[model samples]
Target: MEIKAKQLDSVNASAHIKIPSQELKNEVQNLAKKASKTLKIDGFRPGHVPVAVILKRYEKQLQNDAEQNLLKNALNNALKELKKDSKELVGEPYFEKFDKKDEEIDIEFILSFKPDLKLDDYEKYIPQYSEPKATKKEMDEKRKELLKTHASLEPIKGKRALKEGDFAKFDFEGFIDGKSFEGGKANDYVLEIGSKQFIPGFEEGMIGLKIGEEKDLNLSFPKEYPAQHLAGKEVVFKVKLHEIEELKIPELNEELLKKILPNEKEPNAELLEEKIEEQIKNEKLLKLVDEELKAKFADALIENYNFDLPKGIVEQETDMQFRSAWQNFSEEEKKELSQNREKAKEKRDSFKEEAQKSVKLTFIIDGLAKLRKIDINDQELIQAIYFEAYRNGINPKEHFENYKRQGALPAVKMALIEQKLFNDIFFFSKTNKKGEK
Candidate 1:
């Protein structure tokens, strides 16, 4: 047997393997000898079947099995010679070409692997971003929102039409072509006006409607509506007003303060204001760090590191992303894609670059974490799990158990490490700039 491996690209390789026919013949003969002892023939006792009869009856089968075993062993040997474990390979080796001649069996395979990444001065590539701060207006709005949550809803004093910010209970039946459709009828549904919870024009049409009054709203469904039958169709919504309730927000006074801070011996407005400000700042900072700054830093890192991505990983990631995006498409859009193969292929191809970037960034971050010795210890893991549970309103113990059962603890740990690494890098960059000044 002879093997030659060549690097096709940074992340891919091609291997040519040749096995001499003599070796295959020898393997087949050895296998036949081993099988003869266990042979069961109607005309002969065990271990007494003629070798010629066995060869004549199962020559092709024995040869094929021997060929398969030889190929597997050869591939394993080749991988060992390359100093790569099977786990390091992406996807299965793709057979590019194969030929069987009287003298030798020749085969070619294309193998994909994770790319080697090299980063120079990676710290300098970390993008600088200003920490977000909450404005007074935003704080005031948050305070008002808190007050509203504590507020009560009261029935309108007298006969009056519903207005924005009023809660209404109403019955609605929608018709297309004078026939009611599925999911188009509801009775006594309470909705907050101006909340935009209903379809476009449905909520706006309910405004100014008095109790016990009925109105037919002529509206057209959006072109991209999820329901295929109703998309872009004109419909009539026969709405009947039931009751109107107005919100009565409590003022930020002594009674409200005492109620909110029952544990405080003497709750004061100054302390409350300071607490609210701090909460707003923390919220703003979290959003900035999680959503904006982290993404920018990742993008900058990706831009700075140039490396070939494993083709198999990029393809799989692209398909996964495309499936997720496809779930959000309107029925008509999906049908169109189903009908046009080229259009669907184009759409899937469009996600390839973004998928490559995402996959490449994952490896880069993982390598950086290892190089920097960033790790999530058991205590940190517990704290992270509890923090996640608190954010998601779940029991920490149950969440940890679920993660463990799903074998997702490693993924969680990796995410925590990446986040900590980025935070540290950001802090170091900021402090270094300050020191330079």
Candidate 2:
């Protein structure tokens, strides 16, 4: 066996692997025997078939299968040999080119892998962040929100009039030019006044209506309404109030606090305030650190390296993004999208540079992860998967399989590792700025 590597570019390597004719013949013969057992032929009794007859019947196929297996096995061996005796091997191996012109047979492959980064000052580039402190005002606001969550609603006595936050039932019919329009009529529909749950001015028009009251609601639909014909059209609604009930908000006290904050026995407003402030400060810190780290990481990687990414990967990613966008659009929106395909294509092309950078960053990160021996534990992976599943309202087991089928397992694993790496890096860093004392 002979192997030689040629550099196509920074990210691509072409290798020529030569297998001896004698070796190829031996491999083919051995493979034929392994395949002959279950292979049926018209007068053959399983493994008892003669090799000459078998060769005569299946030599061509056997040789093809042997060649394929040889390519895979030989490629693996060549990569190992190159890594050990020559330069380092990069990403996954691909069979770029091949030839059988000579009886000796030479196979060529183009492998895509990450390039090396000169990061002598990786630690120095990360921005030093000041530790955040929760504020009293912020904590008070959070406490108020908690109090509102515990607030109870009670019906107001006496028939004054339906107002905002009041539940009301009514019979209404809307008409345009004296003819009833679509979606303009309902009988005994219960609604909350000033809820903005209905068309423009519809809820506001219902406000201040006494029991058994009758009133006419006049309004025009917005120009962007979903119903094209009804959009920007004026309609009159004849509203008849049937009954009204006032909303009673509950007070935040001992009983309310107990129910709302089960973790804190004897919880008070001050304790709730502290918890709220702490939550806000933690959220702000995490958000700021995550954004900064991503930007810094990308900048660091890009600063040290520059190369042309494979068009295949970029096209694949773009197509995936395009499908995602399309899936989010409605049927009419899809038609509009189709009509503006050139614009969409232009938008996609504009993202090519970023996509290239992303690919490079991914390759480098993956390489660094391997070099650092970074591995995600089963528990962490499962937790991340479960969190995502819960957010998407899907069963974890089903979602995991779906993610794998969509070829997103690598992405999920990479995301989990990247998050862990950043968290570990930030957890112990000291701050020299802000409220640190």
Candidate 3:
């Protein structure tokens, strides 16, 4: 087997592969011998047919199979040789032609390879981030929310009107145009007044209705309601209020504080303030770290390189992104997208350059991993797999093995590499926000 390559473009190259006649003959003879044992003929028993007749009968099919095998082998060998000479083959090589018209089979490949990149200087970085500081007001607010979460419900006093945050139980029946519709009646339904849980004006109409009070709820469904038949239709609900209750938040005493924060030496305002401030500080620190990392990573990428990206890779990425974006849209939104197809196309076309940059970044990162001997340990991989599976509600071990089996291991490898690279850059880079004191 021999391969000859010619430069077609910055991102694409054409290769002509040739398989020797001797190799083709050997493959045909081997396949014919294997078929002779099972092939049946009118005049001869199985395995007794002559090789020449077998060749004559199955020549076309055998030749096709042999040619496919030869092409695959030659492509693999050619790529391996190219990688040895130039280590920038970013993605898979695509085949353009494979022909076996005669003894010497001819094959052509349009390879999508990476180009050279020379990063510009990016040692100086100016970061931007918010510095959050918790005050006494913020702490008190959090404590108030905590008290509300642990609140107790109390029955309302006699002859009192309903109010917001008050729980009520009632029986009601709804009528539309003097006819009662299905799912229009309920008994002993529990509702929170002013929650707006029911249709527009339904909850507001329930407001001010006391125990054992009977009234009418006049409301109209929204125009864009889910039920097409009843949407925008006016309906009257005959209300009968049975019982009402009010919520009473508990006092923030030592006992309540102990229950919430166990093992605390002192459960008071000062202790609570310290805890809230610590939590806020940690949150701010994590957020700042993330923002800094992203800013630094993008700067590093912009500073380090420029290259002509593979058109096929960018097109593939754009299609993937379009599918993802389309899947997130509703049926009505899909129709809207159809109407504005040109606008959507414009957005995709704009993303092509960014996608190309991303592809080149991926290739460079992979190259860096090889150069620096960076790798993910088994424990780290197992933990990552566990986190992914737990988030998606799947069996961790099974998910990990499935990804490995499906040839998605490279994705995991790249993720690990990118994480490491980002961390390395963040630690080494001198970063400070513009307004930091």
Candidate 4:
């Protein structure tokens, strides 16, 4: 037997093992001797069968069993030589070579270990920003929006022009630099004035325009607009008003109050208002660190911390992401990629960067969770799964079994850890900043 092991990087190792043919034969004989004691061949008495006869009867099975034992022994020896515990290993160590040669069986295995993340002062990665707060005016607007949810749109009876808080349907075409742009035109688009869903100054620009009125409104997209081409660009929208309507909100009386708060103790208009305020405040708090903020925080953390990732783990993530994207690709795309190996590789490689980031964040989150002692116990995890299942009208036991079968429980746990870790960071960081308990 010969063994050689080397750490390739911080998180990966390589091992080469060799076993001579004579040694392999000796192992096979050992297994045969053990099996001979328990042999039950019709021609042989139990515990009295000859080793030669046993080998003859189960030559292939004995050899395979011996080979498996040898593989385990080889890995154990290699790990001992490397001064590493098998418990510290990441995913399975895969064989790069397991070929039988003239004199020996050669084996090469690549092992990946979890990286040691020194996450000192990691709280510096959290992005600093003011939390969103609900103003009285905004609260009133929320109350009105809630009212509109249960309201009906009624056409105006009189010849009234469009005004603030009025709903209008109109045709419009937008031009940029004297040329029309994509998504810059609409036909009979219904809009509520002061809703502020469109470009800034757009709804307000439509104010005072009457039915059958034709006008042109100049506007500019916000500087932080998602569309890069149209961001902060001046544009002209030629508009023609078609009709006007108003949201006929139901009266906030006893009947509507009961409908809004059926289970409340003595439901009333005051109770509804209080519920609306609470709902609006809760929404503002939940959305305080929105997607954009989370993304920016992730970016900052990735930039701040640098570490080497396990190559095998990254490859696994990249493969998974690529396969997920491939399933969503149109049939034509699949066919195109299938015919061109290079294009297929390029498409797969496109996910590598993102996979690397995802793996890094996973490690970072793990380290943070450890630092904060954040955890989701088995019972908590079970309760979460059950709650989610019930919310979605799924059988809790069935959902749990499905997750177990798909090997997704770890992913769920990790997500929960990440969520709790961030929540702790945000809450404590904000409270400390405010000098509050």
Among all windows of ten consecutive residues in candidate 2, which has the lowest summed lDDT? 428-437
A best-first ranking of the candidates according to their TM-score comes to 1, 4, 2, 3
Q: State residue 4's C-alpha deviation in candidate 3, in Å.
A: 2.3
Tens-place lDDT per residue, model 2, 1-437, is 68886556655656789988777888888877766776777787877776777677888987898787887777677657546322444444555456675468877776555456554444555555667777777776766666655554455578788888788888999999999977889998988777788888999888888888999989998899878999898999999998876554466678776777789867986776666776887777778768775577558766676665644465556666667666776898677657897876775676576677777777666655665567797778778898889997789999888887988877888887777656555554443233422
Instruction: Write candidate 1's Cα lDDT for 324-414 as tens digits.
Output: 8999999998999999999999999999989989888888888888777777899999999999899988999999999999877976887
Best by TM-score: 1
Q: What is the lDDT of residue 287 in candidate 2?
A: 86
Q: What are the runs in model 2 whose C-alpha is more than 4 Å off?
A: 5-14, 19-29, 40-43, 48-64, 83-90, 100-105, 110-123, 128-141, 160-162, 165-267, 286-293, 301-356, 363-399, 419-429, 432-437
Report the CA-based lDDT of candidate 2 relative to the real structure.
0.72
User: How much does candidate 4 score in TM-score?
Assistant: 0.62
lDDT top scorer: 4
Full-model lDDT for every candidate: 0.84, 0.72, 0.75, 0.86
TM-score of each: 0.64, 0.62, 0.61, 0.62
Candidate that beats the other on TM-score, 2 or 4, i.e. the better one:
4
Compose the digit string of candidate 4's lDDT tens values, residues 141-203: 887877877899999988877898899999999999999999989998999899889998888
